[model samples]
Target: MAPTRAVAATQMIEVDRLDRLLGAIYDGPTESPPWNTALQQMREALSAAHVTLMLRPPSSESHGVMINTGQVTSQGVESYETHFFALDPFVRLPEGEVVTAEELIGSQQWLKSAMYQEYLKPLDIRHLLGADIYTKEGIECRLRITRSDDAEAFSAEDKALVKLLLPHLKRSIRLHAKLDYLECDRQLFAGAVNRMLVGMVTFAQDGSILELNQEAQRILAEKDGIVRSGTGIALSSNHENRDLQRMIRQALTGGPVEEPVEGPSVVEAMSVTRPSGRAKLGIVVRTIPLGEFTGAKQRPAAAVFLRDPESSGTQPSQEVVRRLFGLTRMEAALALLLAEGLTLDEAAEKLNVRRNTARTHLRSIFCKTGVTRQTMLVRMLLNSVISLG
Candidate 1:
């Protein structure tokens, strides 16, 4: 074949590999330890000893994150992060350009650098190809590829290949960061709701349960008032179930009004009776607008929140209560005991303090909380966001 034809054939082969590389890159957001597969593919395609991705650069405060594929030792990784990271001289290259250590600095100069001599040399990594990626969201990361001392230097084609992958890698990394943030937010909200002792159940349009929190699972497992019936949920009372089912259907249909609205009237609320003669469960069925919820094969159509009135409310921590009400630790303890329905003398006896001291704390709590009455103090503390912490 002619030189042009030979180059064309080589390009065609690389084009096939590019498709797989792109697939791995885009699929990275969904992967656990994201971009592992993509990095592995890049390593194989480039015939490198190791491929390291610096998701976050090391700082004085943090060691940051590093993901690698191919032969890598834990000790080497730790040393790089803890000691040699600051000494690295080949970092912060022109964004998106692939350059080798030798190209960045002279071969002799690269070997003489502290980072190379003290770190990379011992690891058997002589040839280094690096690219820096910056996203619109202000994420800065590095892609580092290494080869052994005897290995051939990175060629022009290798540089070109890395340059081609940069855009896809940048976008995928941004997507992964966004997804990670969203997941963290979801956990934060879920934890707050669980701490408040509320049961949450996400339902599909078909009335099947999509997701349920820990509290909901516990409530259903007890089967006092509500229980899981197949993929759906059920109440012990037949009449209550009918009403609950009606509310579910209405919520799934977006109610009589097509447009979304805000307020307590937008959703239906009811009291569910338990066969065990316990207090009624507060049930609120609310519609989830179709347009608001995106992605997932089975989207949540309605949200069912169950609040057990008989169950003791979340016990607020004394420290949190103290911080919230600006009261001393003793006053905070007395306030909690009062919130739990204990009389002043009874609280004093339990606390092993004199009645006069208890009265002094109560008076101080009232002054700090701006509530003159004991009932108001109890209500204020119970309604506070201290438990959500």
Candidate 2:
């Protein structure tokens, strides 16, 4: 084949591999292929013995995901991470640019370096093609493909292949980071909701249940007046059931007319009667506006907050209270006592502190929480989701 035709054929093959790698990277949040597997495939395509992706490169503390087809051992990788990374010359290369080891430090200089003598020589690593593909917020992601002592040096074609892959690798890393952040946020939100004393349930526009917090699950498990039926919840009383369904419809449809012409009258508080002469459950249904950024039609339209007045309130974690209010341990304890409906003097006695000291702590708590009165402070603390934990 002519040189141009050969180059075209090689380019076509690399493109096919790139497409496969891109597909794997984009496969849903939970389903992306492992970095090592993708790197290994690229290793084979580039005819290199080793491929490594270093995150936050040049920092000795930074780590790397490496795939080696040669004699690189786990201990060698550990040594590289623990020590040799500080001496890695390619890490300091210009961001978003691709270069070879020889280009960065000529063969003579690389061979003379202590890094090569003490580390690379032992692993039989000789040639390397690398690129700093991504850089942001002091973090740099570098890709390196290495050849062994007996293997041929990286040619222009090999460099071209890596250059072609740089942008995709950058994009895939960013996508993975974003998905990780979203997952973390979701877990935090779910955890906070699950720990709440108030039972909470979110519903779609059609009144189908979207999600229920742990408290809601517990309430439904009791099988009192309210129960879940298929995807939707049900109330025992025909009148109450109809009322709930109507309220849900109103909330979904942006509230009722003649009730309030103000902003949105999408809030309704009702008492749900239970069987066996049990106390009625208090329920507040409120519309959950689908924000502009959330354009999905299937998003939740309303949230129902259920409160069983007979049930004891869950104690707010002291550590959480301190963190939220920027209070000391003593102040947090005082706040919790007040939240439990204790008067300032009663709380002071309970905490074994002098009334004057308790008064001082209360003032500090007021300043930190931005609430002036004891009633307002108690109300704010009770309504906060932190108490759920």
Predicted model with the maximum lDDT: 1
lDDT of 1: 0.87
| lDDT (C-alpha, whole model) for all candidates | 0.87, 0.78
Q: Per-residue lDDT of 18-123 in model 2, one digit per residue for the tens? A: 7776565455224433365667677777778888776545344456554344446779888887788878766667766678877888878888887888998888
lDDT of 1 by residue, 191-251 (tens): 9999988999999878899999988887888899789999888888899998888888778
RMSD of each: 3.5, 5.6
Candidate 1 wrong stretches, greater than 4 Å:
1-14, 256-266, 292-296
lDDT of 2 at 314: 64
Candidate 2: which stretches are off by over 4 Å? 1-16, 27-40, 47-50, 58-77, 121-124, 135-139, 148-150, 175-228, 235-302, 307-314, 317-335, 342-389
Error of 2 at 162 (Å): 2.0
